[model samples]
Target: MIRGVRGAITVENNIEAEILSATESLFKEMIKANKIKAVDVASVFLSVTDDINAAFPAKVIRMQEDWTYVPVMCMKEIAVPQALEKCIRIMMHWNTELRQDEIQHTYLEKAIQLRPDLTKQ
Candidate 1:
């Protein structure tokens, strides 16, 4: 069965540089945790917090890596009060035989505190 994995990062600033750095780290950890390869991923959906209107994190992610043809989408995260700031989140649907418990989700930086249990799991 296929599985969906999620990951997130918190940017230090709204600037493109900070966003790129955080996103890069986030993607690395996410792919590592989930044992993902280009062939395993079906699609990735990325969303940035309202404060991060500078650049699309997903585009930066693709540019940083030579992903040639993987499908990635970007959007703005809902602006909820007291929500995480300058955050970039991703949901990747992958074709895998792993069970739900075997799927790994990464939440790094400030996002690490979002779900401590999952981070440890």
Candidate 2:
């Protein structure tokens, strides 16, 4: 079976450092919550709001030696009126037996408001 863990975070600004830091932090937490090793990851898709163009989110993941071989892609999120800004979102596919509802989805910083239902805990 395959499962996916979703995560998103808002960066403090559009600078490369801030984007990389926030994205890396979100990836770490999502990976931890899913209890998945790099080898278990099939692929990762990351997208950021139009407001963010400072860096490639996948580049930050590749910086980790363990993820050197993991397949990753980064793209710009769809621009919608009043859409979340400085938001980086990732959906990681993992080969696991966990059911859909069993997986954990994480939203950090202002992105948390994007999924208020999940933040209840």
Candidate 3:
């Protein structure tokens, strides 16, 4: 089955280093929480707030040791009024046998407020 694991993190600035660091951290957490392997990932879709334009979050995934072949796409998130800023959201399509409810989602840094419920898990 194909399952989508969600994760999000907030970066301190639009600098490329900061964006890449935060994205790498978030990606690691998501992989650890869901016990995901790069080979099992079908694809990844990453979206960032309009304020973040220094770098593409997908670059972090490609840097992983065995993730070079994992399909990844990055785009700007919708500019919602009063929504969180400097946030990077990820939706990873994974091939797994786990049920929907068994999947784990990660929300970190200031992005924790986006899904308070899942953060507690």
Candidate 4:
């Protein structure tokens, strides 16, 4: 079966370094919480709020040796009114036996408010 794991994080600023750092932290936490292997990831879709344009979160993740072979894409989040600012989000298409309900979703920093229901699961 294929499952999708989601994750999001907030960056304090729109700086490139901040975006990259927050993305790395968010990805690390998501991986740790779900116990997922890089080899199992089919592809990753990353998006950032309109306010964030200093860097592409997916590019930062692709720097990992294991991720070089993984397909990744970065896009701009729809600019909805009252949407979270400086937030980066990721959805990983994983080839795994885990059921959809068993997949762990992660939300870190201020982004936790985005999906409180999934944070603890």
Indicate the residue-level lDDT of 13 in model 4. Answer: 88
Ten residues in sequence with the least summed lDDT for candidate 1: 59-68
Instruction: Give each prediction's root-mean-square deviation over alpha carbons.
Output: 1.6, 1.1, 0.9, 1.2
Q: Compared to the true structure, candidate 4 yields what TM-score?
A: 0.95
Tens-digit lDDT string for candidate 4 (1-121)? 7789999999988999999999999898888888888899999999999999998888777898688999999998999999899899999998988888888899998999998988884
Write one digit per residue (lDDT tens) for candidate 3, span 1-121.
9999999999988999999999999999999888899999999999999999999989989989999999999988999999999999999999999999889899999999998987864
Candidate 3 local Cα displacement, residue 121, angstroms = 6.0
Model 2 segments more than 4 A misplaced: none
TM-score of predicted structure 3? 0.97
Candidates sorted by lDDT, best first: 3, 4, 2, 1
lDDT of 2 by residue, 1-121 (tens): 7687889999878999999999999999987887889888889999999989988988989988689999999988989999888899999999998888788899999999898876536
Displacement of residue 52 (Cα, Å) in model 3 is: 0.2
Name the regions of candidate 3 deviating beyond 4 angstroms. none
**Candidates, ranked, TM-score:** 3, 4, 2, 1
Largest lDDT belongs to which candidate? 3
Better of 2 and 3 by lDDT: 3
Comparing 1 with 4 on TM-score, the higher-scoring candidate is 4
Model 1, 1-121: lDDT tens per residue? 5688989889888888788888888888888877788777788899988788777788765774546577899988888999888789988888898898898899988888777888974
